[model samples]
Target: MQDHASPAIGISDLPAREEGYVDLRSYAAIGDGRTVALIAHDGSVDWYPMPNLDSPPVFARLLDSENGGCFELHPAQAHSATREYIPGTNVLQTTYQTGTGKVRVTDSLNTGKSGRLPWGEFARRIDGLEGTMELHWRVAPGTRLNRVSPWADSTRQCPLLRVGDVTLGVIGCAGEELNFSDRTVSGTITVEAGKHRLIALISTRHEPLPCPDPEHILDGIERTVSYWKSWSSELHYDGPWSGEVLRSALALKVLTHSHSGAIAAAATTSLPEDPSGGKNWDYRFAWIRDAAYTLHALIRFGEREEVHSAVSWLLRMIRKQGPDPEVFSTLAGELPHSEHEVDAPGWRGIGPVIEGNRVGGQLQLGVYGDLFDMIDLYLEGGNVIDQPTARLLADIADRTCDVWHQRDAGIWELTEARHYTSSKMGCWHALECAVRLAEAGQIEGEAARWQTERDRIKQWILQNCWSHERQSYVWYAGSNTLDASVLIHAMSGFDRSERMSTTIDAVQQELGDGPLIYRYTGMQREEGAFVACSFWMVAALAEVGRKAEAERLMAQLVPLANDVGLYAEMIHPEDNRFLGNLPQGLSHLALMTAALTLIEKY
Candidate 1:
């Protein structure tokens, strides 16, 4: 509700093509826990999914700029724009300056007085800051991503657009009636200095539509600001780049599903990881590895209630899936299909816009350690584990002893299963945590077997995966490639020896792109820099007693994030453009982990 003096991002050089699609870096996110809407710097609501973040979007201009629908608002005359998040909140304020005047538009998916609203609300407040300005706005609620035909009915006092069972209502076009053409709603309004206007979009899914006046939506906006400020004030962090850390916390909250306590991997899906197409996958579902990392970060932030719910939810889902669970699952505890291509054209004409993740079917042995480590951290924070959950975890540790030798997808979820050294280390970490749990009397398991296998894994990795020539552990057995994933084992307390310390330098020399790091050795030609790998390296450096180097690398990495402190899944090292999904949870989680590791250990 209150705009602060954050640095403004100028949008004078926005990308423009035949379809008028801008770069992914030209957007900022606003959410109300259940869903997020991406507003481009040019005043277009490009991507918004209704009811849930994983649901089919009514506005999908980010994927298909032509047929994909959008909610657009900008000045009628030629102008330039600047954007920023109102401090301490996810609300976005975009100021457009024209030849005659300047106008400010504030965007938010409003919440209730205390918590989330029963329905979905998208509010935009317009204020005339100087001179007289005329602005144009439009709302079209349909996308080519799904099979829905939107039709406008001006029969009621307010204009309504219906898409299948969903009803979208438009309000606030003072002194002028809305124009309904085809399936789109459009209008124009003029305002002088010292005057303001309010426009809101209220929607419903498979239910009757409710007609609310402008003042009701306005109240929701105020409540939303209050809720965000209250939630953010609880995050206890005062380390270096404290502002960046707080912004990452707020961005992580945008990806968290409030109802189920499941954190999504990212907000939008099928945004290309590279420019030439290929490697597009849906990130709407929750990966156990990502959720575990998120839980670790939240615990370090001194958040109790949400961490409890997330640990319970994750453990419950893992238990439901029985042994050797897959990599990810839907927020509602359902399994996503392996993979499928949607019907829409992707961003920048990139095809094969995927709907589900292929990793859902792959066997990632590394997840065992992620699960056990999550439980270990939870218990370390003075939380108690129930008997049944403890027993189930003990059973999982037993299975890890049996499956440690089997080749699988590893942490990257590759199609070709290999004996990845990181996978073996993950299993070793899981067994070590199990032994600790047994020693603490939290779980009843075969501590001796776990210890034997853990030792065997350490010896095996040194024998088969280590390279005497490079003086670092390879990606897999009998290979010369180095993987950034090996950096994660440092945080597991797996290695403080000369091998890990030397491997850190090897990875830095082979994969480092300025401040960013690639995922692996040979894969640098395919994608941009993996956003979380650098953070993992930072934690690894701190773990290996190179505290000064960790501090310096952390300083470089924190400034690489976008102006609003939200990072995508990848970033182009050369051009500094955002690639892949926006507001990636793993990237933010790793950031919190690195920052906290420095504060706690070094």
Candidate 2:
């Protein structure tokens, strides 16, 4: 351990990028429950947003390497690096081994005593494990990619970075002075054997930002690590792939907003799904569908508090904004504003980085089922349903009955409205779950009407969505194309018949590349196979009693996760590179579900 306030000598010069770009898979995530930071294997904090997850990123080097800002602390000489989490915690440890020496660096976004800190706190601890090693550090805040220019204020005890209304302060304990130039703070320190160093970056939105004593910041890091470890200790899971399941659970917890209980779909945005730069969308907001799946995974692992809080937050949002909520909303329960393109060049020079989600207004009929399933899971976990939530569930169930037949955007949220088979099946599942709840006396509802509509929705799916010619349920009515989402019937219990088994085979044949499955027809040629859909296929395989195939697919898909077991929304099939938003909650949740299904069935 090292003293927190020990000053380090300043190095006036900056180091140039040795590597032109980093692979998306080379980044691992750490968060403080309010926002996440993506750190590359080379010890650079590439993507981080100050104050909140959706705020403009102060470090956007992941999107634009040259102009975007970053905080980097690595060996001045060439080194080989490997990293891992501090077991059961989001704190990451990276070890760099050079010809002459080895050094270990631990990174964390410190949480406060109670919950999230009012301001952001990032810490990097460096230790000399072998011989002496010279380490260089630079703190460069992008100010939303120069949308706001940054100024250095050296009048304080420690240097302060001022950009608009926000301020960032850098401090360390190495007995060296820091140099400030061009809004960047640069320093160098040599750590001999048995010596260590601690450097931190702190940010605040309020004017006259408070810079706590360095010793206090160090205490916060220790407390934050303990907090995460305690939370992980509470998780109860003994199924197959328990390690991966716990990793996914921890990743989901990182995505969860401590203040509002809203779980973001992912921590990042505008990591292109397509290399041609066509399909990029922001995923920092909460989607009803994604949140429902996240809850399902968490519930399986005996997580109760966050699930209850999330359900309560969602119900409150529904009450405030009415029963028909947006497909997505901010963590605080407001519809996200219109989508706009940012000026920053996207990852790999992909243009038109997006800000807000445009699909919030889309009528995704599956949300009805998503909400119902979340409530059912909560009640199944022995949690009581309040009166208002019970009534809201009943009303929403009735509304689903009324709108099950109408055409709308399906689970994929495509622009075109169609009689999607999966959407109708979702309504059927919702009504069926509602009927079961009514039978159990959890809520007051008309079971007969709900059953009748459920059967009707089933009949419609059987009549229109199925393609006898293709021997599978098509993506929608009157279309022969296969959809990966229809595999949800396996988990939703919409169907367990042999037809679903054949449909699973049909989907694999048409859209799957071995264990990885595309989202729908023709997607393999356009973009990478969706990582979630592939996991869904694994679950569906288990549901169909294809234990051998399920196990094989699980083995294949599990390795697709990066070194730290984090997943992005998509992966390029050709290169196995991560694409789209990282630490994707949907992908992690789907992986957990598939693991659970395999453990239960086999």
Candidate 3:
């Protein structure tokens, strides 16, 4: 398994400072009301989906570099690029300085207007900065992920309809036929210093021809930017880390399905949290764990409306499906009983790109903690915890008390079922929350029973999770594996005993390669150090009264962030290249929590 880490098809050997595509540094995120797109500093739409956040991506080069299509609006000449967002909005502006001239490209999706479904109309506006610059536009559709070649006929109101097996009516921009192929359209446009050209892509189920006029599309673009700025102003968070918090709030808002209220684990699927490591999992669906983080982040940012809606979505998942737990769906809002593969090529030869999460059916005891904690938060925020939420929490907590002792998949979603220490700790957390709720005069439940259950869980963790041999709590019972998750002990308040100290030292000594921490060495395969786990380690250090080490470790972690504050799922322990989904919610939330913990601790 360790050999997989040093694959024969080696990544670029050039110094990390010089590589271009190897680094995802030059892109910014833009969101319309419904979906988010990654726009590069070079004016290329690297990743985007149409009509819906869960819809198959129309521009997916971020996954399969060659087969996946892209929408580009970059200078024809070589250029230097810089990217940023308009204050308090998801409107991305990337400027390019070329040999011939400079151009400013703005990418955005409009949302929050009076009437708009949770669909997408991607808008790109290219403005000439100085001198005449030649701009290129290409619309390439791919066969991956059920994306089919578009049927182009300018005879109707919409010029092109890129139809696929599952997706219908993916609209594209048209002016002159530059070049058309099985799945692409390319052309060149020249703009003067003060002139601007606008392009838009709208996805509908009905394939229409002769796309709507560019001028009308430009109008939509203006309205979209206006809507983003307006809506962004409503966020009440002006916290210690306000900038990153706001960006997270914006990203989460974009990934959310307005109609369903499901916040996708990430905007992308199959982009390995660790490339070549097979750690990739499709995150296009909703996870109860992710939903918990979303609720917490929104609450931190003081977005109550989104908090209410997101909690409702989460409760819907718990309620619609009967008590027997299962894996949750992406947009459908239920557990998918089977692990069905979608007809999509995997990202960058990463095979078996899937839609539904198979963990839906697994017994994950951690969700018990997530649900109760989020409900408690909702009530504390003055929102009524719906009756369904109360009933569901009580039921799940009782069930956890009954079965948390049983072995199951850990938080990493590993294959084998075991007495994962973290899983049991999560059960302890849920009972603790129940006890807190009863004390706060919130709900009626057997709080004393829950307390007893909680104590039992703690006792079991100390007895079973700890390894006298390793002088630390191993991954689970009878295993000497040192996992980064054990560092979560301080954060979970499991114990501040010598056991935690021993566990932290063991993880740092064994799993900690430099500053980052691996989930577990060869627990499955050799992958980059898990970035979130690194942050968890930092948080744990702070809680365990190692402020100096915690501050130093955090300093190391923050620089791993890209040009923007986005941290991927993992990073190369050697060279800090991002591996996994961009702007991962878990990574960001961990960073936020760790920062807060350190701040308060110091």
Highest TM-score against the true fold, candidate: 1
Model 3 CA deviation exceeding 4 Å by range: 1-27, 115-119, 144-147, 156-158, 165-183, 207-216, 234-241, 273-277, 340-345, 497-499, 523-525, 600-602
lDDT of 3 by residue, 138-210 (tens): 7665544554665543434544535563232223344554566655556787878998877666665543322
Please, what are the lDDT tens digits per residue for candidate 1 over residues 129-154? Answer: 99989989999876548778888887
lDDT leader: 1
Clashing pairs in 1: none
lDDT by residue (tens digit), candidate 2, 352-384: 688998897788889989988888988898988
Worst 10 residues of 1 by lDDT: 1-10
What's each prediction's TM-score? 0.97, 0.95, 0.88
Better of 2 and 3 by lDDT: 2
Model 1 alpha-carbon miss at residue 226, Å? 0.9
Whichever of 1 and 2 has more TM-score, that candidate is 1
Candidate 2 Cα RMSD after full superposition onto the native fold (Å) = 4.8
Query: What lDDT does model 2 reach?
Result: 0.84
